[model samples]
Target chain A: LAKTTQPISMDSYEGQEVNITCSHNNIATNDYITWYQQFPSQGPRFIIQGYKTKVTNEVASLFIPADRKSSTLSLPRVSLSDTAVYYCLIGGATNKLIFGTGTLLAVQP
Target chain B: SQTIHQWPATLVQPVGSPLSLECTVEGTSNPNLYWYRQAAGRGLQLLFYSVGIGQISSEVPQNLSASRPQDRQFILSSKKLLLSDSGFYLCAWSLGRVEEKLFFGSGTQLSVL
Candidate 1:
């Protein structure tokens, strides 16, 4: 499993865009970048996943740089209900899925 | 669509008591099941995983044990509970492989006194 590093916490207001970056310097070729959003007292929900370049979905977008060393999760027009912990995981079929201390996003009014 | 059911939603047990938490998946078969524990203000820790019926893999050496008796039923048990076992337990399942996206249950909050 590739170790990931992210900001401990971030602050955002309603209608603002929030981008959380995760650094995985030793990412493997077969590993994929996946992001999950977890509200308090609930299971983490899948937000977006990408192998490379950019992938957009109904909820969020994932941007993977050419070097694959890092990826960013972009959430547009944040709201108070969007406050949650965001996790960035990098793994392949043969690797163990480990969830590290994720970035806590506080969406204020 | 698939759904996972886990119970009891909240449990408060004595330290020396035995423990059993059941989790079942509906609308899917031959799925990979996993048990994870999360302490307050901490990340998730994978405790056990099962690939098929009667086949289980333990990720951590602890007081808890898991069993897969049927295709869609996963059970977590302990002969004697410990205070350290108190945490939020989550059960998840994936369609085919471990690396695939997972669907998680509502989770159980366990407190051992």
Candidate 2:
């Protein structure tokens, strides 16, 4: 399983865009980058996933570089309710998906 | 549409007592099931996973054990609970593969005193 490193916490104001980057220097060729959002006392919710390039969904966008060593999760127009812990994972069917200490995004009014 | 049911929502048990947490999935069959533990202010730790009925894989060596008796039922149990077992337990299932996008339950808050 590839380990991921992310910022411990980030601060952003409402209506602003937030980007959380994750570093997975040991990412494998078959690995896919996936991001999840977790609120207090709840299970993490899948936000976006991408193998390479950019993939956009209604909730968030995932950007993966050509090297696949790093990925970014971009949240547009943040709101107070959007505050949560964000996790970036790199794995495939053969690997175990491990959740690291995620980036806690604080959306302040 | 599929849903996972896990209970009891919150449990307070004394150390040395037996523990059982049941999770059942509806609207799906033969889904891959997993049990994860999350300590306060920590990341999720995969405890066990099952690919099919009666086939379970333990991820970490601990006091907890898991069983898959039916196609959609996963159970987490411990003969004697330890204080270290106290944490938020989450049950999740995926469509076909273990690494696929997972659908998780509400989770059980376990407190071993």
> Residue by residue across A1-109, what tens digits does model 2's lDDT show?
6889999999999999999999999987777788988997898888988889999999888988889899999999999999999999777745366787899999999
Q: Which ten residues in a row have the lowest lDDT in candidate 2 chain B?
A: B94-103
Alpha-carbon runs more than 4 Å astray in model 2: none
Q: DockQ of each candidate's interface versus the true one? A: 0.57, 0.58
Per-prediction count of colliding residue pairs?
Answer: 0, 0
In candidate 2, how many clashes are counted? 0
Candidate 1 residue lDDT tens string, A3-32: 899999999999999999999998888888
Candidate number with greatest lDDT? 1
- How far out, in Å, is residue B8 in model 2? 0.9
lDDT of 1 by residue, B1-113 (tens): 88999999999999999999999999988988889999998888989988899988898998889999999999999999999999999998877543568778999999999
- How does model 2 fare in lDDT? 0.90
Worst 10 residues of 1 chain A by lDDT: A91-100
